[model samples]
Target: MSEWVDVHFQALETCGKRARSAANMLTVEDVFQDSSAKKPADAAQASMFGDLSHSGALAGKVNDVWSALKEELGTGRSRLQGVEKAIDQVETNLRKATKAATV
Candidate 1:
């Protein structure tokens, strides 16, 4: 029926919107801190200290961003799969209805 088709389409559109929002959030980096080097070290010890500090901070930020992006991607994938399954169910139902009408 047209009603059933409309329902399925609406559900699919909602899922798609959610997935896109999640993807956009995952791509954004404003929440993540910048890990740029502050200044050049004058001495060897200072250089080593700066290197260690910068590397550690950068690594932590990178890890956090990676984890957040991964979670978002997983959520998007799950939503997409749900939408696919819903569409498949609708198609199956439509086919069955058509077959019944024919018979």
Candidate 2:
């Protein structure tokens, strides 16, 4: 007697495709670039600093945060691609093994 294992390849592929699409969408330039709030943040910071040679502008900080987030999204996208490839290889190997066993 042999135990049976069920794998849904279609579902796996669909999930991978959706994840990749989401990651790609986040990495697009328009997501957070030139956000409208930035101008107001800069103005507010300027009013508080009033030419005191301050280095803590809210707008700059916000930009740095956005840059870091974009970089992270890019990294996540790469990782998702690697994961999808690994899943494909696993599916192929499993199919080959199953065919060999059936024969």
Model 1 lDDT per residue over 1-103, tens place: 4677668767756765665555454432433435464322331233344657576566566567766766776676666666656766766677688668868
In candidate 1, which residue ranges exceed 4 Å CA deviation?
1-55
The 10-residue segment of model 2 with minimum total lDDT is: 37-46
TM-score of 1: 0.46
lDDT values, one for every candidate: 0.58, 0.64
Q: Between which residue pairs do clashes occur in model 2?
A: none
Clash pairs detected, candidate 1: none
The local lDDT score (0 to 100) that residue 55 gets in candidate 1 is 65
Quick one: RMSD of model 2?
Answer: 5.7
Q: Candidate 1, after superposition: displacement of residue 10 in Å? A: 18
All candidates: CA RMSD in angstroms? 8.0, 5.7
